[model samples]
Target: MDIILTSLINLIVFVLGAAIGSFLNVVIYRIPAGLSLLYPPSRCPHCLTRLSPFENFPVFGWLWLRGRCKHCQAPISIRYPLVEAATGLLFLVVLWNTANPVEMIGYWALLSWLVALAFIDLDTLTLPNSLTQSGLVVGLGFQIARGWDNGLNPATVSHALMGGIIGAVLGLWLLDIIAFVGSIALGQTAMGAGDSKLAALMGAWLGWKYLLLAGFIACFLGAFVGGGAIALGWLQRRQPMPFGPFLALAAGLTALWGETILNAYFNLFFPTW
Candidate 1:
């Protein structure tokens, strides 16, 4: 019975996450387009027909409508349903990992913000300073609050804060150097401001050690995936590709497995910390 109840709760959380994902889709699409996310409501991009409540039911609606606008039968972007499903899966993972309601909420909030950042960067190739800056502020405040609640020493708190700042600055500066060198070598911009902002945000959340780990993981994943695509003849040589999604993925993985990874590395190398 307890197991069944837990499963049921997770199912509900998934559903709720999908609902929030639907709204996030609006934000992702509209914000970059310089349109109000809430003013005119969701409409068919082709025909501009307003979507009714039933017509906006996340993945189900897209499936039922056959991936077309209800009024004009125009094809809709597949991103909508994909985002909703992805968000639902992310929420399910968070729910599985956390039993504390407050902690769950914090994780959910972080996940939502990350999702928004990921899509926005994918579309615009620029992370809005607004979102990244706000995330840094909020994440630090939350960390401080957690530290205080746990009765951590002020020295520890100070160390974490300094580490976060140093990590963020280092990540951003390293990316800047890479972009400069890549531009000189390739004659085009290799990384965008968005990528730098994202690295900074990750540093703010995970501190210097995890930031380094995330960067290494992102680079490895991007190289593997990009190489696979090239070998498959899907991406041409010298063709530009978005790197934000891969970075976001790396950050997400780090969030879940950073402690384990750090512990393993320390055990193997230093063993005394």
Candidate 2:
């Protein structure tokens, strides 16, 4: 019975994640256009035909439509289905990782938000203040709620969360500072304020120390991909690429495997773990 119930719950969570992914697609498209996500219903960019409810059922809908608009038969981006699948899969992973009900909700919400943030950053090279700021606040709330849920000391929880917030902001600032100096040396702006905010927001959830792990991973990814792009002549040495997606990706990965990696690091160097 427990196994069946768990499977059912996981199915429901995955569906919910898909639903959120659909909404995220809308947010990603509309938010950067300075449009209200709720006001303007989703439409095909090719024909401007409104997508019917059944036609908008996330991944299955995309499959059913064969990746084309039902009204105009215009091709839809394959990225839509991929994003939906990724979000659903990640949701299931988080559900399996989380034992607490509240933590499950919090973690899923955080992942969904990150999905939207990442795509928006990828497409538009901008992270809307709405998503990043809300994620930060919600993450901090989750931290406090976790402390209360576990019956931990209020003072300790407060101090720790504060420390996380401070650490993330300072960490982001440090990255920006490095970028500023690099720009002076390299002759182009390499980082932006949006990435700084995203990093600070990540700090809210992972706190300062693990936020370092996220930053490190983001930097590595940036270096690897940027180097490849440069080598391919797809990008100039001074051209800017979006950093928010890398930061979001790093934060999501760190949220999952950060402690394990951090402990391994400590074991290797400090013998503390």
Candidate 3:
């Protein structure tokens, strides 16, 4: 009975997350387009047909509609269902990682922001200052709550706070330097302001030490994927690729495995510390 109840709860969380993902899709697509997210309701971009309640059932709705607008027969972007599924999976992952309700809710909020940023950056290649600032505020609140709940030593909290600040400063400065150099070499902007804001946001959440890990992982992943695309002749040398998604991916991974990664590094270097 207990097992069944747990499974049911998980299912409910997944469904709720999917619903939130559906709404996030609105924010992601409409915000970049300069459209009001709430005013017109969800409509077919091709036909301007407003989506009915039955047509708006998150992942299932898209699948049931066969990926086309009901009225105009226009094909919908696969991102709708994909985003919903991704959010659902992330919800489960966060629950699994943090059993504490407070921590779970906090991380849920954090991941939602990350999801929104991921899509917005993919669409516009820009991260709105609004989202970044909001995330920073939320992250600080989470840190404080977690610190208080866990009875962390003052020194640990101090370290974490310092780490967060250093992460933001270093991430921004490093990206700026890279952008400056790239502009000189390529004679154009190679990085977007969104990527910088994203790095700072990640820093605020994960702190400086983990930010380094996340950035390194993102760069490595980007190189691997980009190189593969180049080798397949799918992308040319000068093709612009958005880096925010990769950073988000790295941040997500780090959020899950950061402590283990950090501990391993410490074991390798300090051994007794």
Candidate 4:
């Protein structure tokens, strides 16, 4: 009975996540284009036909429509459904990783932002300040609330504020330094300001130590993927790729398993300790 109940709950959570992801798609498409997210509602870009309620039902809706607009028969991008499904799976993973309700809600919000930022960067090579700044505020606020709930000690409040602020500032500083150096070497912009803001937001949530780990992971993955693409003739050696996706991926991993990964690294190299 417990197993069955747990399965049912998981299913419900995944559906909830998918519904949220459907909204994220609107944000991803509209925000970069300077459109109001809530005004016009979801519509077919090709035909400007407003999507019907049944036709806007997240993953299943796309599948049911055969990935095309009913009114104009224009093919819809598969990315919409893909984003929805990925968000659903991501939520389930977060559910498995933590039992704390507060943590789960926080992580859910973080991942949602990450997903939207990643796709937006991929499309436009820019991360919106609105999302990044809002994320930072939310993260720090969450830390303060959680700390206060634990106790009313001054030390506790100071630690929470310091952790969030220092982590965010450190992330921004390090990225800016890297960008400056890389720009000098390349004679072009190496990283966008948006990337730094994204990192700062990440740091606010993960703290300074985990933020460092996330940065390392982002760099490593970015290098590997970028190199592979260049080698395969998909990109030129000098081509600029958006770094936001890699950063988002790294942040998500760190948020979920930074401690486990760090411990494993130390354990492997310093087993005697």
lDDT of 3 by residue, 1-273 (tens): 999999998999899889989999998987777878788988898999999987998899999999999999999999999999889989999988887887788778878989999888877778888888788777766766666667668866666566677777777777777778878998878888778878888887787778889988888898899889999999897888778889888888888788888899899999999
Residue 185 shift from truth in candidate 3, angstroms: 4.7
How much does candidate 4 score in TM-score? 0.96
lDDT of 4 by residue, 135-202 (tens): 99998987786677568887897798789899999999999999999999989999999999999999
TM-score of structure candidate 1: 0.86
Highest lDDT against the true fold, candidate? 4
lDDT of each: 0.81, 0.83, 0.84, 0.93
Question: Using Cα atoms with residue i matched to residue i, what is each candidate's TM-score against the true structure?
Answer: 0.86, 0.91, 0.87, 0.96
Q: What is the lDDT of residue 69 in candidate 1?
A: 88
Model 2 agreement with the true structure over 32-82: per-residue lDDT tens digits? 998888876878889988889888888999999999999889999988878
Under the 3 Å rule for N, CA and C atoms, how many clashes does model 1 have? 0
Better of 1 and 3 by lDDT: 3
Q: Distance (Å) between predicted and true CA of 105, model 1?
A: 2.6
Pairs that clash in candidate 2 = none
26 Cα displacement, candidate 1 (Å):
1.2
Residue 157 error, candidate 2, Å: 3.7
Decreasing lDDT order of the candidates:
4, 3, 2, 1
Model 4: which residue pairs collide? none
Per-candidate clashes come to 0, 0, 0, 0
Residue 171, candidate 3: alpha-carbon lDDT? 77
